[model samples]
Target: MNLLLMVTIFCVMKTIRGISLQKSTSHTFEMQEKRFVRSLVNQARLLSDWTEWSACNATICGIVGVQERYRNCSIAGEISVHLTICGQELHQAKPCEMPCITNQAVSLGSWNNWGSCSVSCGRGGVQTRQRDCLQILCTERFLQQRNCIGQNTCPQWSQWQEWSECSRSCGMGGVKIRERSCQVRRNTRVTQVVVNDILKRVSSPRQSSIQNVNASLCEGGDEVAEDAFPCMTSSSCRRNWSSWQPWSSCSATCGTGFSSGSRVCSGRIGSSCLGRPARYRRCYSPPCWSSWSGYTPCSISCGTGGGYRTRRRECRGTSTRVPQYMTCRGSNAERELCNTETCPVWGQWSRFDKCSKTCGSGRKMRTRTCVSGICRGRKFDVVSCNYQPCPYWSQWSSYTCCSVTCGPNGTKERTRACRHGGYRRAPFMNSCVGEWREQTNCSMHPCNVTPPSVFDTFECGVRNRRQTNNFSSSLLRIFGGQQSGPHGWPWQASWQYKNCNRCSWSHFCGATLVAPRWVIIAAHCIEESAQSMNHDNPGDLWSIVVGMHRFNEDGERYFIRRAIVHPNYIYRDVTDADIALVELRSEVPLTTEVVPVCLPQFSQPTVNETCFITGWGYTGPASSVSSRLSTTLLEAEVPIMNFTACQMLSPLYQEHLNSTNHMCAGDPVTAATDSCLGDSGGPLTCQRPDNTWYISGVTSFGFVECGTPGHVGIYTPLISFEEWVRTTIENNTYAAC
Candidate 1:
């Protein structure tokens, strides 16, 4: 028989058949050191029908290698073995039958009839013909399959032998010898040759690897012969060649994914990406790109990245306003995009289709699309548009310019000119795209042509005959829903902005002078500084009006040099701190009309208490911004709930409130005249015992139906996170220009 020589230094090394240990170069060997054993059966009885082999009175040590010693030789399948690392057991193997051993040397055990350990004791290897007389130990058993039927004896059918010798063939979920023969059962102390083989496995040396592996193998998932187990070089068994190229650098022209750089290129599964170097995870490709450019545009190598789809397309149009999008399932195509979330003309015009946003009538706009489609890319999954409508200048390519049919109360406009009664602070929207500063004056162009500016207002305040006491009780503010003009889309604006913070009818913003050089207002009054003023520079905001309590009769028009919205201020995204500062071109001359209001040194509003709100919003809803800055005096009783209660009404908040960061207020319901239209940035002032009106929540967001109850309104508490505010303010105020 050929004497196969395994030079492994691990605990279980084997030799070729008819091979003698005396022929080996080494003698002394390390013993199998295991701390504890766990029994799967709770109790196992020694069978009287056990086949005992006649061998020397040596102990059974678990060890495997080529240069093994004889006389005191170890055996395979003699006893179950296990080891413990850290606190976890490498294997809670079967409670093994203890074998006899003397010195520290390995107490050689023998293999059964199938094991090469035994021979006749005579020239034909005599003394070993008897079932209890043969002993030849080699490499440890790599894979085993077991049946619930045979825990002790071989199955009646020879065909079942492949299924019975498992670490746990009966997998209700328990231990089983794995099929990874290349797996070296190491002991820290092994020959250099054995250690070299250990470096090839793709699995970690961690205990879980062995346990999980054994579990899979025992269930007979797959089997590898004992000869092919050690080296694991047999290409037919393993998954990839990474094991063979452990230290090799990725050379693929597509470096990360497959090893395509080789003379014989490697094939990949999906969009090719680099393989993760982690122990367990397999190599995969990257997701497809809607706009393929830079590294993102590069094509994937072999693997089907993560087994997803890649697609692309382009849009073209001439006659109608509707843009035409063409899509295809290929990485080579150009990506097309549409503005509408649900494109009626196009099916999944998303990234897979390669269309994200579309150009208007002319093919002037170029859009890099967001990934979306029926099929997934290598790294990207096929998903839908989870964002808002296309931003201004962002053509509603998908929705088509089919006359952007504004729902009812509004119309589209080419320019941003507001009529008299300029602003009651209603969101007067305007677009900047293709906005030509025409040479002709207002006489030639008129105010607006195709898409009229109906929402914009001038100085003429609408007449309402209601309450004479305050602005809120006025009848003009009570009515809403008026025709702003002809409604349509294909919106002309490349960018859009409004007169106030939001589009709602309520005039929710208030202007005040908090300092000599600062015009104070609510933080949320504006979001994107770029579009609001037709100014790309956020620092160029020019003027702000403050001091005067009413807009119908203007008292002050303060010129502003620079405006700064709170960095932390999220627009439409509400928080408890709602404060903003506008740096004026010059300091204010404090007089009755331009007097500055002081922020509270501390919080003073009690729960279930009453407070006041004032604004220039309408007494009756008008078609445009309030002609005059009107002030309405209205009452509110604090409901006195926690942030959670208030947050329940709006999802934009709740993430920024803590003990030191905001307060909750507003009556569960308020009387008819709270801050109605255009009441934003106004202070929720509570009259204190000291006769001082302390500012609490800043009038921020509320329901569209202003002044009604049950709709909890939000206020930015001046006290919460007051320190952060002060520091930020002081730091910026003292900043060197």
Candidate 2:
């Protein structure tokens, strides 16, 4: 029954009590109420599943937001007042947060119009503009400067010195080094000043003070003092013959024999020279004894009378032409006496000796000495004895996978067992010399921390173009790469240098856009550029081009406002800590063809995951100077390899690999499938399960050979420096318009 029926029953009972009804009627009403109550009490109540949560009520950041879900209830039986049935909860609510958003009018600072030149018009006049950032609103730049008319007085760089000879004489494992000095030029006078002051600063304290004053006047100061480029020479070379040395004396005394003479291939020392260096010719030598013939069956076998044996040898000459002059040196016959005097009677042999070993293969021996130094037969003897197997340790089992993707908290274990006769047994359990179980630390790389929400300045990890059938499948090296479709990698940014003619930009390295005004790249690129300029900052001479698919095409270009290399990075040394953050002069306009890539999360890519590398780097074995850099961006897929597996690919890698800061990846089975020259600072992007791409690594260095098999590319994993990247971008984002 429903609730209405119980109400009716209660009203009827009250009416019966108010009037002078018979006791039996009143009792009957009470009994009926009791029965209804019992029925309601025993019945069950059901509630429908909760509805989906409502959208957060709050839209602004930093405010508490709420979401609610609700359900409907249903009853199966009658209800009464006496016993109450419990009701199920029908509504729920939860707290949530809204995504962060910035107020552009407040956060974005603007530059005031350029003030008039200090003077009417002259090369020495300076024009300045103040970056009017609300100090309370922005933390970036506040002032800027520019030349009014002609270029400012700056240090002039000398012509690059001729490239030195290749470090190696053969193969491609070599480098060429060259250097240029910064010449301080004031007005029309060329002053031979050591801008870096390496000599003056080290020689005397008095000279150091003078050099410091002059260094401040130089344009961009040098950060790195040297520059090097990889070079290659042919593996094979023509043999350049050298004069032959005098022949050695004849090998033999009189008859014909052989003599050898040798010469050297002196061209390109240390390089492989084809053909033999030594030659042989016949010479005269004396006659010699060849070999003695076997002795006749021992004369007088089992004899008491004395007997003798004789053997003869033949004499040989080197040549018949010299036989008359070559006299024989040694005798051709030999003789020996045997079975002399009467032979003594042999004694009986003694019992065999005890076996040498208790188990496994061993030896035993028995001996009988001669009675009177006249015995005719053998005296001592030995024979094989023990043949049983011994207990030994079995090979260790493969180690287990690491517990964590990255961090020192992970560990792995393996085990082995003692065995006998190739099978484990009770007797062999304690015979093994080593431990039964072995454990080792693994995946000891630094862990990545989630960055602050403020750093999310742009939409990331999303690509607009759909991959086509022609898109290459796997990655590691880019040698076997395919052309990337337009806007295929929206975050791809080219680090270009303005050529001397200032007519076109030449790409030197690749970078990944992580924000509208921030990019991540290898540190060596910045160091190399600094070494070429006299000013302390090299960003002025560089441009970052985004949204461009091919060289010689137009793109959204921006100059680097400032650059910060990882603190641990050593200039010109790219083996470790090879990461840098570059801030653009202005924010890039976000579009389908221009976007940023997502930074890596705490989790790392799986070993089998196929990551991609896209760049205009050299796709052939030729050096960067050989014009092998591609004109269009190319992409290839490569799988992640564990430290052990990566290092085992090459002995050189094993010696230099650092598991904590570097990631090893590539198509180890495919030749020319790796990043090469000009590919440095490119992204090693990996796709997550959500179809978003994350910048897992930054291309640092690889094998000298463009894409030789068994040589994987080395990338900076960034886990160790992720915090630095986040802080650098957050603290130094370009605030000036």
List candidate 1 segments past 4 Å from native.
1-508, 528-530, 533-542, 571-577, 618-662, 732-737
Q: What are the per-residue Cα lDDT tens digits for candidate 2 across 1-737?
A: 45556446545534533432233344444433443343333233444677999999978543457899976655554322221133234567755545443445445357889877654423666666665445344434454557676444556556757877865455443445555565655577777545332433545878767665554343333322224444447763334767788888887774566788998877544343556899889887666776789986557654555577889887666456764545566687777777665656666678778878755777887777666536766787777676666666655544556777556677778766656543333354235455678888776335685334544546789888563225454432337777887778999999988876766678989999998888898988887663363222444467799988887585778876667778788633335688888877567898988889888865678886899988998877665354477877888878888878888887877777787778888867765467778889999999988988889899998765767766788999966677788776665532111
* Residue 445, candidate 1: C-alpha displacement in angstroms: 55
lDDT of 1 by residue, 1-737 (tens): 11122222111322211122234233111111100011111112121132334333324532211221112111121232221111112221121222323333332234334322222111222111112212343233322222222112211101221222222112111122211222222343221111112212323557445533543322121122111112122122112334323433333221123332222223432112235433322222222224543223323222323222335433221212222212223445443322323222212332344434332222122223334433222333343432323224321111111122323332222322222223123343222334322222111122244433211211111112222233233244342211111111000000112234554222335654445665456765655333354212333223455433233233444444455666676543334356666555455564433334445666656556766544555443334454333442233334445666765654444454444435555554443444444656665656566554445656665544454555555666777644544454555443312
lDDT of each: 0.35, 0.67
Model 2, position 127, has a per-residue lDDT of: 69
Which ten residues in a row are the worst by lDDT in model 2? Answer: 78-87
Most lDDT-accurate candidate = 2
